[model samples]
Target: MAQDFIAPSILSADFARLGEEVDQVLAAGADIVHFDVMDNHYVPNLTIGPLICEALRKHGVTAPIDVHLMVKPVDRIVPDFAAAGASYITFHPEASEHIDRTLQLIHNEGCKAGLVFNPATPLSHLDYVMDKVDMILLMSVNPGFGGQSFIPSALDKLREARARIDASGREIRLEIDGGVKADNIAEIKAAGADTFVSGSGIFGKGRAEDRNRYDTIIGEMRTALASVGR
Candidate 1:
């Protein structure tokens, strides 16, 4: 399994003060900034773009920005995100007309690349490109919005992805996104997700500037992860 990483999704953050939200989450010990980029055409919702990423970097957020691009025609935006200081950029394989070339483009711009598998998307997409990816993000809920319930089936998919990663013998992160919370984080971890993405789960009933609120929520997640012995 990959090393444990807690990536708080900023989708649920108060976008009016996005940079501060990123800062507070990291300060509370989140391992990565799980950015959700949704193009209305691809997922029925329009969201932050590369400029927001650039703004975060400009605001001094040096922690890894895990960019999840839920956009169609993904290739065009790869360079902009890479230039914006995205540490890891992953996109839906189906969105890219040429998946390999898109992955190569991200690497060419100095960013780690990966593929995101939606709830029903097949694993066959990984057959030829396994080695080319640094991470495999498994969405537990259909992408587009945050605060959705996790699909029980995703656990099985995480197990399958873990098996594939083990067989490859390459260091690849197995990330689980959507509806991850302290109550089920251990189960998710046990299912083989080393990187956990939580939106409402971490920002529960709190204002973005409340660092203590972030602290308490994140601490509970840490405790949950620790209990799983991962």
Candidate 2:
């Protein structure tokens, strides 16, 4: 089965009502919560960490929390996020000193492990650790900020990555992050991305006072992906 998943990035959600936003999005059919963990050092942006992840759990949001570690010294935070209720944890290969060990650590903590490839990061990172990953996140745009235009080169990269995953014979997910919207989602899926992460593309579309647009935008994306039988 082609499992097309839509993970709404909480980085663009209303911070004051994060729990509500998460509840609503999940209710609206989001597969996962794309939690952005940015350290000021690694990605030139400082965002939330395990504390908020924990809070979300405490708030009764039991959906999978897909934590993206945009931080250096990634190993130390692995245990924290795992303890805080993360279901899937992914970190940039360039940020981790020992890629295999980091993936091992995440698995050891009882979460699905993944490796993130930045817009310019090489696919060679997957050469040794493909066996260790549950998902491969391809950044369609740079990591630091949201709302950037999708980079077209990602289509080729996704196709190449898809071939590698198919050859690996593992059920690893191919996730595309940044600038995903309804219009281009089908093309992205056609390129072999089964999972998606969209920040401004979803949250930025609604009027400031209305968060219910989450359902509308997410449904549109699902419809787009479904139209092609993804």
Candidate 3:
């Protein structure tokens, strides 16, 4: 694997102060700033958009913005995201009617293009475009909302995706998002995920039983991640 794991998700950040929140995480050495764009029709929750990415760039956020679009008719929105200065634009393969062309459009815009797979989506969906994209996102949880628990089955999917990438002979980056935390991060890393996305894992209020243990959990996650050469 690679020593580049921490991709902090902005979904768990205080959106009212998004710029400041982004700066804080960037200052903490976060590799990519993960942005989740949700449409109510596609995932039941509606969230940020291209304007936010433009705003982040205006605010001088230098970290690459990883845009994860959980919406249908994704083609209609890719251009706006690219124009908004998104360094990497990823769309759900299940949501697009023509995944190949959509990915090509993203690449043509001079940005790294990627595809996202919901937990229930099969690994084979990536077969055609597996070599064409710069990265592949495997959702470890359902995509609708933030703060959801990580699904363990996604680890098996990650393993399979790694196999696919390896067999394809392409150096595509593999990212695991949803319900990621300190304890299981190593599992995903061992499974060949170099990029890790943590929403509730890094910023959600810690478990009620743990009582104000967020910092501890974050530290442990970082330490474990560091050991894996991430």
Candidate 4:
């Protein structure tokens, strides 16, 4: 399995002070910055684009930026994100007219490529492109929104995706996004998720009052993850 990662999604962060929020979370031990790029057409919500990603780079955030594109016609925007300093770019397979080509496009632009599977989306999308992807993101809740409860069935999907990764003997990351909190991170890890994405779970209330607010939650999450194999 790849090293466990805690990617704090910026969707739930206070956008007015996003740079500080990201800096604080990373200092609190977050492994990656999960950038949720939602297009109103594809996911019913509009979110930040590559410009924000470029701004973060300018803001001096050096941690890996995991850009999750919840947008249709994903191919056209691949180069923009790569140029914007995205370390990894993941898109839903259904959004791309040419999944394989899109994956290649990301790599061509010098960024790692990944595919995301929504709660109901089948894993068959991985059948042909397993070798082409650097990561596999499984949405525990539906996309477009944050703070939704995790769907129990995602556990089974995680296990299935894990099996595929192990079988291929590839270093592909199995990432689970949405509703991942300190309380359930261990269960999710035990199910074979090496990368965890949390939005509201990490950026909960009390942030303004406590400069160290992220420390407690991130520490608790790490503590939970530490107990997974035991």
Index of the highest-lDDT prediction: 4
Which is better, 3 or 4, measured by lDDT?
4
- Higher-TM-score candidate of 2 and 4: 4
* Candidate 2 global TM-score: 0.97
Clashes of 2: 0
lDDT per residue (tens digit) for residues 105-136 in model 2: 99999999999998899899899888999999
RMSD of each: 1.6, 1.2, 2.9, 1.2
lDDT of 3 by residue, 1-230 (tens): 44655788888877787787677666655678899999998899999999999999999998888999998989999899999989889988878889899999999888899988888888777877776798899998888888778898987898898889888888788999988888888887877898989877766644357533455655677787677643
lDDT score at residue 27, model 4, on the 0-100 scale: 91
- Tens-digit lDDT string for candidate 1 (1-230): 45689999889888888888888888888999989999999998998999999999999999999999999999988888999889999999889989898888988999999999999999999999987999999999999999999999999999999999999999999999988998999999998899999998987645556544688888888988988865
Give the TM-score comparing model 1 with the true structure, all chains together: 0.96
Tell me the whole-model lDDT of each prediction, alpha carbons only.
0.91, 0.91, 0.83, 0.93
Candidate 4 whole-model C-alpha lDDT, 0 to 1: 0.93
Find the candidate with the highest TM-score and give its number. Answer: 4
lDDT tens digits by residue: candidate 4, 60-106: 99999999999998999989999999999999999999999999999
Model 2 segments more than 4 A misplaced: none
Query: Which candidate do you rate higher for TM-score, 3 or 4?
Result: 4
Residue 52, candidate 3: C-alpha displacement in angstroms: 0.7
TM-score to true structure, per model: 0.96, 0.97, 0.91, 0.97
